[model samples]
Target: MEVSRIRYWLGVLLVFLAAFCFALKGVLIKLAYQYQIDALSLLTLRLLFALPFYIGIAVYQRKREPVAPLTLREWLWLFFLGITGYYLASYFNFIGLVYISASLERILLFTYPTFVLMMNAVSRKRGISRLQWGALALTYLGILIAFAPHIQFGNQHNVLLGAFWVILSGLVYAVYLVGSDSMIARVGSQRFTCYALIAATIPVFIHYLIRNGFALLNYPAPVYGLTTIMAVFVTVVPTFMIAEGIKRIGSANASLVASIGPVFTIVLASGLLGEKITALQLLGTAFVLAGVSLIGWKGKKM
Candidate 1:
């Protein structure tokens, strides 16, 4: 029991660390945008820097433990998850960040658990519980409260457009989350993460080639430096940490711990990017955190 308790807490810590790293993603991307890089180009650079590490890890894992070959269905699922999870979801997020505050971006993205709950209820052919209904109400109400201030007073030229993209990212990410659990169980977390990330990387490279070609490599030195940091610290490290954390403590618990992300991002954005935090934003964040925590708690209960 003691060993299990230690393992659980370790998983919680890993997830907390992963959330902090993820929170840095928005600030870094916002900083990169200062150099006038397009979303695709920036995302491409991030994956380009991250690709080698994932490949090296996959190779090392193979050498360390010769796993069975994956079935065609598994390969297909990996491709699907790769496209939706990292590629589309991240692309939308990057684009959205161009038009919204980093704090708002994180707040909107943090609503994915609501989408996940809805998706699960649909798939299971069951109605949502009363607790879930209340949670959903609080979550969306928080988004509305948080968003209203931005629309009225924020300087962003296209807050609605940005919110749309980020919300879409959250929706697609929910799909990825729903699909990934079974795959993770089947393939093992490390190998599944490596394969899924590699699968995501191919399309990013191809998109960059088709859209901007070699022009993306000519960014200012700081742009590359920022992206490299993003790749290593934000992308690679957190990806593995969350995967391993989920393996140890299950996704529900990991996600509950990760609820710290939006608040962390708000703080980081304020300090790093000069984004302001308002009373309304804080209240909305509280609502979102409460709703998400309730969902995770109820999920674990069920």
Candidate 2:
């Protein structure tokens, strides 16, 4: 019992830390844009830096545990997951961040859980509980609180466009997560992530080559430096950490622990990007957090 408790708490810590690192995604992308790199170019650089590490993971997995080769169907599924979850989702997010505040982007992207819940209900052909429905209400209410002030004060069109992209990002990512349940079960989490990321890296490289071609070499030192930080710290490390966290704690608890992500992004955006923390944003943050808390608590009860 004591050992189990230790493992559970350790999993919680891992997931919380993962969420913290993941929270930096919006801020890092925002900072990277200051170098004048377009979304695809920066994304290419990020994937370029991350690819080697993912390859290393693949090699390590192969050596550590010799497994049967993936079937064609399995490979296809993984490829699809990689594209939807990482490549396209990331592309949309980077583009979206170019227009929106990092805080808002984070909040919008964090709605994946809600999407996942709805998807699960649809797939299972079951109705959501009153508690869940209420939680969803709270979450969206919080989103409105956070979103209204910025869109009201800023360029409404730009903010709305950005919000649309980020919402798509969250929806696609939620679909990826829903698909990942079986994939992660079929292959180990680490193996699945490594392979999926490898697959995702290809499209990123291809997209960059088509758009920028040799322009990648012309980037200044600061751009490279920032891309390196994003690739290793924000991309690779947190990606694996979250995967391991999910494996250890299960998705529900892991997501609950990750509810702190928006708060981190909001605080970081204020400090690092010089973004303001308005009253509405604060109130919205509270609502979102409360809604997420209610969902997690209600889930535990069920």
lDDT of 2 by residue, 1-302 (tens): 99988888888888888888888878888887887889899888888899899999889989999887889998999999999988998899888998899998988886777898899889989789998999999999999999998767774448988999999999999899889988888878888888888899898898888877888888779889888988888888887888777777877788788899999999999999998888888889888888887777776665
* Runs off by more than 4 Å, candidate 2: 155-157, 299-302
lDDT, residue 274, model 1:
92
Candidate with top lDDT is 1
RMSD of candidate 1 to the truth, in angstroms, is 1.3
Which segments of model 1 are wrong by more than 4 Å?
none
RMSD of 2: 1.6
What's model 2's lDDT at 239? 77
RMSD of each: 1.3, 1.6
